[model samples]
Target chain A: MSEQQKRTEIGEIGEFGLIDQISSKFTNKNSSTLKGIGDDAAVFGSGDLLQLLSTDMLLEGVHFDLSYMPLQHLGYKAVAVNVSDIAAMNGLPKQITVSLGLSNRFSVEAIEELYKGIQFACEDYSVDLVGGDTTSSPSGLVISVAVIGEVQKEKVVYRKNAKENDIICVTGDLGGAFLGLQVLEREKAVFKENPEMQPDLEKYDFIVKRQLKPSARMDVIHELGDLGLVPTSMIDISDGLASELFHIAKNSEVGVTIYEDKLPIAKMTYDTAVEFNMDPMTCALNGGEDYELLFTIGQNDFEKIKNHADIATIGYVDKRANGLKMVTKNNNTVALQAQGWKHF
Target chain B: MSEQQKRTEIGEIGEFGLIDQISSKFTNKNSSTLKGIGDDAAVFGSGDLLQLLSTDMLLEGVHFDLSYMPLQHLGYKAVAVNVSDIAAMNGLPKQITVSLGLSNRFSVEAIEELYKGIQFACEDYSVDLVGGDTTSSPSGLVISVAVIGEVQKEKVVYRKNAKENDIICVTGDLGGAFLGLQVLEREKAVFKENPEMQPDLEKYDFIVKRQLKPSARMDVIHELGDLGLVPTSMIDISDGLASELFHIAKNSEVGVTIYEDKLPIAKMTYDTAVEFNMDPMTCALNGGEDYELLFTIGQNDFEKIKNHADIATIGYVDKRANGLKMVTKNNNTVALQAQGWKHF
Candidate 1:
């Protein structure tokens, strides 16, 4: 409490380091709190079915830009990302609460448009918009969403449950959302530089939509349910695949060995990354915001999903001493590095 | 869709109007969602025990000034207010998720101080800190909290169940939080005008504490349970007494009548208001952020809490035709007007 007290900058610790520091000081007191700060979603309850809770906050200028991002897409993306967290837990989202802090610059109609998308997502996910608080912000919009989901206790998955020989799989694709962001940024720059010039977005539609209206893989969750498959470990790729792989490795006390040839990247995403003079494979590994499902299934369950079209077997788990590495198409082995999104 | 299109400003409809507009467009698709919107908390689940979910967002500048409001109290208050929403539904809070948007101006220690307050509230309320999202903000701090609680299906209270003859009651005193804010703002102004001037806060400790660290009335909810009585209707007084009374009336389809002399007001709060050249009774009625419980209990349960030390019987519910009126100490009746907080 002194003026010359020790001061540590938040940037020095970064996001994950700060999380570890904060979580270290606290201990869970409730018996029903099955999990707390470490996982994608907090788990609780003693019944055969347990509840999951997760929240995400998006600031207007930091997480989005009104100049290019539509309010409707922003609303939809907000709900979708939270829904993705529930899906990552192998749970079905039942209810969600949205809290918004809006400045007076926003019109009632603008808010209506935002809610229209929220309603669309509510219907799409079959989740109810239960309750929220709307208050005035001093500046930009602040949207925070909290979702409640339920999963059968026997089938619940955590990042720490994967075994040494589990198979790693990713659904849909990766790098598209990140590549989509690059295209949008380029267009925004062009539009800002010359107001009279028309910003051509026709060719970038696929990646643009990937960034703006990315869907949570509730479909994949349902498919997994139908396939009668439960992953030993699961995570949503919101912060790049390599970063999440590190999480799985650290939590599960295992190493990862992925093949570059097997990394899921759409043709459009690859071509766009190439057009931007970026490595396509690097983009797929580090370009986050895909909201794709990344899970590890035991080898015994591999026969069930191997022929599935949307899913790609990307890697296999290894012993903790093996470390995380990738094998290239040329048969060269290299260490995998994670360039995760750094908010700080 | 065009620049010439009609656009209604949010100021025209205010906060409640915006909420009504949003809630009207959405319908519950999940059978587990027993209640959605238009209440202190959303109720879900079909079991003998139902779940409650509620969220609140607090913004810097609009909600608090860091110059006077310590980060610790801000964190405690952020949790307390959300827990108050659960208490309003006569439920016990069990889990909470805190989402914080912070600017780099805050140090790691500053965030730790903030979390310390949150930890204190978690201990006080016996609610587990389940999950949360923390990200960088462009400007000031933003805090959003969502809480999940549980209540017996038969005992859960709602805003729309007050009967004509139910006895309206309030716990603790009112207007103290508002008076505290007045004192703090005055002190801030004084300090700003003359940096050399030391704030004389000793005399205003009680009221000031009320503003900075208001406690949710969970204690009263426990007491009511012990007395084997459940309120027919209830709401937390966050936007002042008169405003909340109107909510109960509109939701329950009943009228409200209260005695002016029966309204609880702390002596210090009354004295501080007088010093500020403000009406003490008006502050108690229209001054917001008190976070006290206002409820209506059946007359048959009157004797159960007749001599309760903290609870004060203010009036009785009335037929809708009677209108909302207050009987003055001078034997004159005046229709109550709600000068609620206008965030816009």
Candidate 2:
């Protein structure tokens, strides 16, 4: 407790390193806790089924800018992100608890508008808003959401079960959300320079919606269930595709080889990347917050989803010695890197 | 959406009113969600047993001051308060997820110190640390904890089931935690005015510890189970005795009458209240953050706990027409008013 004691800055370790350092100190004490601290959601037992619990905390200024982010969309995004975690485990979300810390600057009507979006997400996802705590904050708004979901024991998927030669697939398009953020930031800067100028956003509507309100790919989960396919490993693309790929590769003890030509990108996302003078491929690889599902399945199961318009088989799992690599459209090989969102 | 629209301040409706306003908009969509929004914890059927879910959020500056409050105790208290909500439903806490938003000011060692307390609480309560999110905050520290517990379907208790003439009981002592806060605040002021002077806290150690490290009454829960005693209604005392009394009265549609002479106050708490020129009785009635269990048992069940040392019978439930009243030592009756913590 002395001032002279050595101090290690949190930024040095970063968020993931900090989590590893803390989670390593404790061990699970309950038999019912099937898995803890390493997956998209914690797994537990409930009779014949397995239950999943996941939580996410979003703070103002850190997660979103209120000047451009609507209160309703923020609320909806909060729920969607938690639901994405549940879907990562191939589980169906059933209940959620939202805790909010509001400063005096907020009005009751504003909070109601926030909850209106929450209610909309609840109805759309068919999950119940069960319990939560409302408290005061000294500065800014903080929203923390915890969701509970369930999956049959046989259908439960984890991030550590990918096998060599497994087909890697990603649902929906990527990089749109990140490009949307670029547009919003650019527009904000322009407005600040001249307050009288009204923003022209009609041309960027698709990418803007992707940033403000991205939906969880529950449809992909349902389709996979109907196709009788269980992914060997799965994760959601919240910290960009490359970072999520790193997670799966590390946990599964396998290497990955993705093809740049096979990566799914919407027209608007590619155009926005060009407009910003950024590489579209880099944006697709590292632009996060798309909330799409990334999974690996047995090669035999590839045919089941190959014809599906929403899913794209972009890569294949390999031996650990191969590491993670990407094959460019111009026949060049490169190492995959992750430049995820770094709040610290 | 207009500048001319009326803006209702959150303070006008208060925390409870805001919760009620928001929760009323959402309806339960899942059959597994047996109960929601009104209880200390939400109840659902996991399988044969009922499951309970609850969450609490604590923000720095609003909930605690790091200038005096230790990081370790804050971590322990965060877990204990959430566990107390589980105990209120007569359930056994099995797992908890703790999400933290830390700023750059907190060092790695400081975070480790905080987790040490979290680990200690997990060991003491026999609950597993499951999964959580660690993100950076723009300012201060934010902690959001979600707990899941289980109870037999028949044994689960709710706040609205108290019958007329039920004996109202409270466990442990009251006002100590509140008085402890007052003592800490006074000492903090003294130290602020004169940095060279050491705080004279030895005499107030008992109450101070009560404030810093209040334990959840899980021992009482186990004892009740062993004695085959199930209270008709139950709740945890977090927002003072009077506010909790109002919840029971309003939910159960019953009245309450308690004797002031029967209120239990620790000697240290009473002396501290007197030292601070505050009424000890008012402290017991309105001072919050006690984290004790409050319940009402049937008359026939009272005999089972009559000889218990920690439990005290303070009052009895009455017809709704009687309203909530307290009889003072002079035998004068007065309507009880709740001045619970107003955070907004």
Q: Individual DockQ of the candidates?
A: 0.86, 0.92
lDDT of each residue in A204-244, candidate 1, tens digit only: 89999989998999999999999999999999999999999
lDDT of each: 0.93, 0.93
- Among the numbered candidates, top DockQ falls to 2
Model 2 ranges with Cα > 4 A deviation: A1-4, B1-4
lDDT (Cα) of model 2: 0.93
Clashes of 1: 0
Candidate 2 per-residue C-alpha lDDT over A214-251 given as tens digits, one digit per residue, 9 for 90 to 100? 89888899889999999999999999999999999999
Per-candidate count of clashing residue pairs (backbone under 3 Å):
0, 0
Candidate 2 lDDT for residue A302 = 83
For B210-247, candidate 1 gives per-residue lDDT tens digits of 89998999999999999999999999999999999999
Task: For model 2, give the TM-score of chain B.
Answer: 0.98
Write out the backbone clash pairs for model 2: none
